[model samples]
Target: MFINKAFNMKYLSIFSILVFTLFSSCNNPSKTVNPEEILIQRIDSLNKAGYDITDYHAHLKGGLTIEELLEHSRTSGIRYGVAVNCGVGFPVQNDSALSAYYRSMKDYPVYQGMQAEGREWSTLFSADSVALFDYVFTDAMTFFDKEGRRNRLWMKDEVFIDDPEDFMEYLVTQIETILSTEKIDIYVNSSFLPDTLQSKYNELWTNERMQRVVTALKNNNIAMEINSRYKIPSAKFIKLAKAAGVKFTLGTNNTDANLGYLEYGLEMIRECDLKPEDFWKCKK
Candidate 1:
């Protein structure tokens, strides 16, 4: 009888351990959750919290058709603004090409954006043709330096960086000019430095310099883009702009079909405490 009792107790202990293990496994949430699901949940939470969550700098390059963009938007839970490059060297340079491009995709649900390139874009496209877009945006990437050399920041050969300090000052002046003179709604690729000076972005973009650009944006009523592709205009710059009541737009500036999720912009929104009111929305 004593042996039988001891055996029964050992079996009971084993059964209890099995039951506890099964219960723990059933209640574990992390084991069943995925990263994509977590991202979607956070996006849904932000949407419910009054954020628009739009990517205003998508491009149709790399065979990225409207159908693919729509599918990506649906899966990611983000709205899109498809942009076309318009300038001297781009595909759509003149007013006729701009109008035809607009007519081709005007029926789509996504917002149409005009990415005005080069300093001569204001002269190339008429105001009436430009006004047809939902919004117009420009960057300081293509500008004539003080030496009268046309510097394209993206192209290594076209860029001329003699003195880093001088280059930063000239770039800041170019940005100020673009914001003040150009009739653009948003300034994409804000605070971009050439690859040479990219590492010194924080050191080069001083408080006074940042204030100068922020002041221009405020004075001209131009929204600054929180570019996810470049992850630019640092958190400090963003906070200063926000404090000065400058509006912002989220952009990807995608050159290919791989439209990355706007991780940097979303992080900035949380870090800088940006609300929906801080963002620029299209009236149309």
Candidate 2:
């Protein structure tokens, strides 16, 4: 495990907490059982089978503190890669801020991740500073449309889809460009679509488009993120990626403190028949 020394000190405590919590739940008079029992069981099974269950896309926004995140890790049995958004308009715009952010999180028991925001992130921070984190990840959600308009896909108002077919081809091209040009470890929020094109996910993300993105990931040696928050990159996409020898990571991309138990990601693991070798681990 690529865990920090401080994390080792707290490992026993976290394990003890999980044991006691489970015991307490079973001791309830009604024995109704906790709803998370299934999730916890799945995590335990996966861990016992040699899988390092982890969440690679977590944030500190929405009043969530590091202590709270650590506590969640203990109970959920999932390690985390806590990231700070860095880009042109983000908080950590320059190397000075990036270094400061790393200092604050270096001692924590979690992997420090940089969520590179826009395409211009290449100019915002130096490669040396970006490499300070355990791993770096980005998405194709922010790109310039053919009209030269900046499109932040998540924001409905900022997304432009003049023609669905044309938009999808352009989106795939942008994704391929990012994978080939950027020095990133993971590609997150894979197969995401704007609000307008969301309903046509299956139609827009055709096999050809999926193959182009998957080929890029495999060629670049980048892991793909199975985003739980968005529940994207349908099972078909995952199976295809796996068939081509592309590894995967689980992510929440949480907006607040509600970091789910990686329900969707776990489902994909089973559906895609992914093995320990099919997952990516950041070696620090």
Candidate 3:
């Protein structure tokens, strides 16, 4: 009887261990989930958070046709405003070219934009032609400085900064002039600094100086662009502008086909806690 009892106890212990193993196997959590799947979930969360992001400054440069861009936009959950650079030295300089450009883009379900290059763009294209585009945008990037010297901030040779203080003042004035003068719906590449003065952006762009530009934008009813490629017009500037009732838009200003979703713009929206109402709307 004792031997039989001991054998029964051993069999019961073996059965208990087998049951636990099967239960654990059935309830095991996966150790690795696909990165793409996680990214999709994150993207869904972003969309849910009420940020209907639209990139207003994408380009079809680098051999990227409109069809290819549309395909990319559909998958990325980003609507695009494909901008054509229209001014002297650009392909779409005159009214005929501008008309053709606008007509060609009619089939695409994207906002067509005119990126006015240089101050001469105002005289180069007539008001009627300019108004045909969904939106028009320009930057203070190329302007005549205080000394009557034309300065293109992007190029090292074209830029001149003798005194940092003087340069900052001049740059601010130039921005205000552009905002007040240009008949642009959006101000692209806002607050861009020359390479020499770029490192001291925060220090140089004081509240007083920023306010001047902000006020100008407000008065002219121009929306500032949060440019992704440059990652410029720092968060501080954006917050200040928002408080001043100046609106903003997201732009990639892509030089190639690979324009990532406005990552920097999204970051600014989160960091600044921007709402949908804070963005500027094009005339639909």
Candidate 4:
């Protein structure tokens, strides 16, 4: 009787172990939750919220032709605005080149844009040709300081900040000048600071500074770009701009072909409670 009881106990232990193993395997959280599915759900959520998602600053760099870009955009459920940089140093500098660029892009269904690089873009291209594109955008990255030295805010060597206070003032003024003077539809890379002063972003970008930029955009009826690449112009700035009735546009500003969905812009949209009406769209 004792030997039979011990044999039965051993069999019971084996059965328990098998049951535990099966349960754990079936309940594995990692296997049960699919990341791809979650991403798709999030994309669907945005769509349901009436968000007309578009990546307005995509480029055909890194051997990704226009056709491939359109294909990727279609699959990702994002519309694209193809832009050509036209200014003093870029490929399409002169009026003829600008016209040719416009002609080339006219074949595609994508919204054509002209990225006005450098302050000289205003004089380089004619207004008639500039109006042909769907939209135009420029950043405050390049400007001439009071001393007449040209400061390219992105590059460390080219940037000049004499005094933090004075530099902030000048930067805000330059932005205001750009917004008031330039006839661009969207202001890309808004409120971007140089590497030297970027560490103090919160401090340097004070309420007064932000208000100046926001007011300029509002008065000029220009849309601000929510750039995904730099992920800049913080939530505070966006919120303030929104409160002041400034419109916004989403952009990746990609240097390469790998255009991921507008991650940061989408986050800002949710975080800032941006409505469809808050965004700007090209009518034509």
Candidate 1 regions with alpha-carbon error over 4 angstroms: 1-33
Backbone clash total for model 3 is: 0
lDDT string, candidate 2, 1-284, tens digits? 65776788699889999999999887863566575877988998998899999999999988999999999899889999999999988898999999999998999999999999999999989989998999999999999988999999999899998889999999999999999999999999998999888898998888999999999999999999999999988999999999999999999999987887999999988988999999999999
Q: Estimate each model's TM-score.
A: 0.93, 0.89, 0.86, 0.88
lDDT of each: 0.93, 0.93, 0.87, 0.88
Q: Which stretches of candidate 4 lie over 4 Å from their true place?
A: 1-40
- Candidate 3 lDDT over residue span 38-95, tens digit each: 5444445776777667889999999988999999877777878999999877888899
The TM-score-based order of candidates, best leading, equals 1, 2, 4, 3
- Top TM-score hit: 1
Q: For residues 85-143, could you state the per-residue lDDT of candidate 4 as single tens digits?
A: 88877888988998988898798979998899999999988889898888999999988
Candidate 2 segments whose C-alpha is farther than 4 A from its true place = 1-31
Q: List the residue pairs that clash in candidate 4.
A: none
The all-Cα superposition gives candidate 1 an RMSD in Å to the true structure of 2.1
Question: Candidate 2: TM-score?
Answer: 0.89
| lDDT head-to-head 2 vs 3, winner | 2
In order of listing, the candidates' clash counts read: 0, 0, 0, 0
